[model samples]
Target: MIINTTHHNTEHKQIIADLIGSPFSLLQKFKMKGVGSKRMIIDKVSPNMQSMMNKVSDINYANIELRPKGILVMINQGLKNFTWIIPYYQLTIYKVNGSSLHAQGRFVHFKNNKTFKENKKFFDKLLDEKVRYDMLFAMPQGI
Candidate 1:
C-alpha cells in the first residue's frame, strides 16, 4: 500500500499503523526519523517497480550536479488488486535557489495521456535530456 500523510497527527498515526502494521518497523528498515511532517511511502512493489525507483534516484543525483532543480518520480502500487493494469504515479521537483528551497509535485493515474504529457513537458523543460529520456523509458509502456 501507498501512504501519503501531510500531518503526523494521532489519526494519521493510527491509520498508518492499521495499514502497515507498525510505524517502528518501517523506521527500523528505512532508518527514517520524523516527529511531525509530511511523508510518502510505498509499502511494497514488484522488482520492476524497484528498478524504476533506482532510475529515478540516479536521475535525481545527476540533475543535482547539473542544475538547481531536481525531480523525483515514483510509481505507487496499492495493496488492492486491479482488474486491469493500474499505474498510479507521482512526480516531485525540488529546486534550490541561492539559499532557498522550492518544490512542486503532482499525482496522476498513469493511464491518462494528457496528464502524463503535461508532466513530461514540465520535466523536459526543467531537467536534462538524459533525465527525461530515462523517465520516458521507465514507464511500464516504455513510452
Candidate 2:
C-alpha cells in the first residue's frame, strides 16, 4: 500500500504522513483516548500558515494542515472512509527531525518529499511568523 501512487490535485491540501511507521494506518488506533476521533474527507490547506509552519524543524512533512476546528488528515481511499481528524490541541508536535515527527508521544515521520520550505509554499499560503508559537509547540519539560 505504501508504494501506491500519490493522489495529487490542483486543489490546495496538506496530508500528514510518517516515513518511520505505516502512517496510512493511523486512522486505526490500538489505544483509545476516550475523546473519540472522527473520519472526514478533507482537501483544503490551513488558513493559519504560521500556526503550522512555526512547528517546522528542518524536515518537511508529507502534509500538515490547521483547520478551524482541528488537524485535518487526508487519507487515500474511497469517499466512504477517507480522512482522519485529530483535535489540533490534542496533537502535541513535540519533536520533528529528519523525516520523523513526535506528536502526542506517537512517532510519525514524513513519507514524501521533505523539502520543508518548498513544500510549505506548495501547500499553504505563507503568513508572517510574528505570531506566538510557544504554547502550541511546547511540550512537558520533564517528569
Candidate 3:
C-alpha cells in the first residue's frame, strides 16, 4: 500500500504498523546495527508509482527501512512523502542493470551508481533478514 505520509495521521500510522510491524526497539536497532538503507538514486518506477517521483529534481531518491515482518520504501517528492509498504512474502528483488524492488505489480528501480554502491552492506543485511523471516514459516520438505 502507498500512503502519503506528509502528515502524522493516526490512521496511517496504525495501518503501517499493522502491515509491517512496528519500528524496532532501541536495543533491537543497536543489535541490528541499523535498520535503514542509505539513500539511493531512483532510475525508474512502475507506471502506477510514477506520480510519487513526478517532481523534477536533480535526482530522485529513496530509502528503505526494515521492520520485523516487512520493509518500507520511503520516497520524497518535494514536500510530499510517500511510503510503499511491502511485506516479506510479497517482496521480490531483481538485479539487472540496476536493482529493482517489485511487489503488488509495482516496482521501483535504483540506479547502480555511487550511492547504490555505498548501500551494498545494507542490501546484504536486508536479504539476510528476509531469509531469516522466511525460515520461520518453512514447511518440512517431506511433509
Q: Considering every candidate listed, which one attains the maximal lDDT?
A: 3
Ranking under TM-score, best-scoring first?
Answer: 3, 2, 1
Q: Which pairs clash (backbone N, Cα, C closer than 3 Å) in model 1?
A: none
> How accurate locally, in lDDT, is each candidate?
0.29, 0.32, 0.92
Per-residue lDDT over 1-143 for candidate 1, one digit per residue giving the tens place of the 0 to 100 score: 23333234686445434432332344542432221112123222334334323333222111111111222222322322111111212223332221111222222223223333334433444344335545765847554
Check candidate 2 and list the clashing pairs.
15-63, 18-109, 19-109
Residues 24-84 of candidate 3: C-alpha lDDT, one tens digit per residue: 9999999999999999999999999988885656588899999999999999888888999
Model 3 stretches astray by more than 4 angstroms: none
Clashes of 3: 0
Q: Over 4 Å off in model 1, which ranges?
A: 1-69, 79-112, 128-143
Candidate 2, 135: how far from true, in Å?
A: 6.6
> Could you tell me the lDDT of residue 52 within candidate 2?
27
For model 2, how does the per-residue alpha-carbon lDDT over 116-142 read when each residue is reduced to its tens digit? 433443222211111223355667788
Q: How accurate is candidate 2 locally (lDDT)?
A: 0.32
